[model samples]
Target chain A: MKNNYDILVIGGGPAGALAAKTAADAGNSVCLIEKRPAIGTPVRCAEGIGKELLKEFIKPDPRWIAADIERARIISPNGTAISLEQDKAGNEVGYVLDRKIFDRELVWQAAEAGADVIVKTRATAPIMENGAVRGAKVLSVGTPADIRAEVVIAADGTEAQFARRAGLDTVVPLREMMSCAQYLMTDIDIDAGSTDFYLGNEIAPEGYLWVFPKGDRTANVGIGISGRKSRDGSRAKDYLDRFVAKNFPNGKTIEAIAGGVPVCRPLACTVADGLMVAGDAARVVDPITGGGIGNAMLTGRLAAQVASECIAAGNCSKEALMPYDAGWRASKMGTILERNYKVKEYFVTLDDAKLNTLAESIAQSSLKEFSVLALIKELITRNPKMLLELKALRDTLS
Target chain B: MSTMLRINRDKCGYCGTCVAVCPEDALELIDAYLSLERECIACGICARACPLGALEVVHEE
Candidate 1:
């Protein structure tokens, strides 16, 4: 790769790939780097994306789309299952992606757009000049090289080391970190067209378990619990193992993947001098659902757009990059993130009985549009005792 | 004299789950290898956060 470019994007996930492609499409020289040797091996995500959201970036290619989810089922602690059809299920009911192929397609598109793509390249440190990030010192395939660029986009996912090294506090709070474990299991009975979510503290404390069908009888069976709730004997894997043992006893686990997702607020400042953070690196994952693929792509594209603008103007200061942060927070994704964070906080506080009561109450009524607000409104109307708490939440939204 | 953290490479998935929960910023996942820095305080948060039970905290005499 070149030692100099207009923009350098760290990480090769959806965020970095989109950033690179967007910037290159804008006629800016861009280079994207991935620490891993391959694009999407050892997939960390559940690979589910909203159909509409996926449409915003790229067409749903069958080569990458594993399952087209037609509905969703929310199972409460009391085994009360609430199902919603595709039209009413909002963004949660969409496509289960094969991320291995999906991520590679994104990078391939980025490369086709005139951006350079390099794998097995780790950004060792930021190349700071007078307290401004000029680029990165990367170890590409064991040979270290200092790459310089006018702007650096940190799309480095959950580890977020590049941002931290560039003087951004990227540490996620222990309580907000979702310790997750997932197993790709086959030979299991599953609704091929429906995604299932199991809620309650007994199963996943302050979190939830999910079963997203890939195809046929194979599915991604996963659980994510609060980091604070994790301990030696009772971790995310422990919970997932117990659930799989009871439910899918005959299932064969072909792949086991574990990672941590930041469910906290995004960084107070996602941009610094000559640097912009995007995707999971910015902690923009949905606090409630732990979904971030769409958000990441959104931020990545926005960051590149803003970076290109600043580069054209010959200014890459933090002030110039501030619009990237403001742009996302003002978008629909931003408003949803703020609302979901609050909703996640409120739901995590509910006990099994409270959840069961709420689930039972909601199960009786049908929501035309299956949004979080719609569900909460249903809860407020059905449960008089939750009126005050739910009203307070609504007030914050307004 | 200090708390020690040991990682069983065989069991470690190198998914960087430990790196994310590390308050001390001690753990770094380099490709397939997971490394520990001197900043590690041995809080065992990473140990607990490890889904594969690949990490352990040991107290030495």
Candidate 2:
């Protein structure tokens, strides 16, 4: 296999695959490296993606969709539930994806676009030359090898180790990280075409529990808790177990998973000379929802587009990649992500009483539909004092 | 040999994160409670992965 290429993308998830495919399709030699033996295994995500966000990039492939969501139900601590139809939620409708197939198909698309695919190849560190990232030291099938490149895209997930190795601050504070645990189980009763989110500090401190139905009698039951609230040996699994015991007493477990989600604003910087960070590495996830697959793919496409431009211009410096940062930040997703972070800051502090009250208010609201911001406005109208506490959020919404 | 990992069932949330992160795949959830199997190497990944601090690795020298 060739050791040198025009672009090298680390991690084979949606971001890496999209970046690699876009770059290669633009006629640059690209190589996508995945540490796992397969493109997608031991899946870590909750497997949900917003429908409208996804439609912007690729057509829905039936093979990867586990279930199509028609509506969502949010149950407050007091069991005050507010249900929202899909279209009413501002295109928040989504699908529970079969990430194994979806992730693999993305890498396959990359390969089909002329990028080389290497599995079981782990990037150990960035190769710095003249103070710029130029390649990586890797352990390929347990053998050390150096792969050189003009531009390196770090698509590594929440850990963001690659970006750090390249001298970028990608560290996620425990407070900003959400510890998640999920079980793919059978014999659980759920609406096959709807998703449920349960809120309450006891249910999931500083986070929420999700029941995403994959099919009849099967669902992905999980919970994500704020790491700050999860201190003192509190586990997300413990909360999930309690929820299941109470809700699905007869449910049987099929698979269990533990993962972390970065739930903060995007990093201040995600690009440097000869390097760019995409996806979770850049903290491109929605702070309020922890949804990232769509943003990751979008950022990947943008980064690659910028990389192609730089290659054509014969300038692979940080200045050349600056547009990638600007481009993403200017997009609709960038604005939404920024707003969501502010929303999370305010929402995470709401107690069960407040959450229940908020739910009740939503149920009584005359509006037929409401966006997240609209809901926030409705919430503020009920508790005017909240306007003072959420000044940043209030200003953003206004 | 007894496994070094001790799961506090009372505290375990049953998210199975420990089971998922266990490099050896030595952990499983039976009836929504944690069960340690023979393959466990006591790697402490599950201990770290446990958000509730429910899984503890007891070191006996």
Per-residue lDDT of model 1, residues A1-398, tens digit only: 68999999999999999999999999999999999999988799998888889999999899999999988889999999988786664445589999999999999999999999999999999999999999999999999999999999999999999999888898887888898999999999999999899999999999999999999999999999998898888989899999999999999999999889999999999999999999999999999889999999999999999999999999999999999999999999999999989888888889999889888988867677656677777777788877776776666477
Which candidate leads in DockQ?
1
| Stretches > 4 Å off in candidate 1 | A87-92
- Give fnat of each prediction, in order: 0.62, 0.22
Q: For every candidate structure, what is the RMSD over all alpha carbons to the true structure, in angstroms?
A: 1.4, 6.0
* lDDT: worst 10-residue window of model 2 chain A: A364-373
User: Could you say which candidate leads in TM-score?
Assistant: 1
List model 2 lDDT by residue over A119-162, tens digit each.
Answer: 88878789999889998988888789999999999997765767
In angstroms, what RMSD does candidate 2 have relative to the true structure? 6.0
TM per prediction: 0.98, 0.87
Tell me the TM-score of chain B in each candidate. 0.93, 0.85
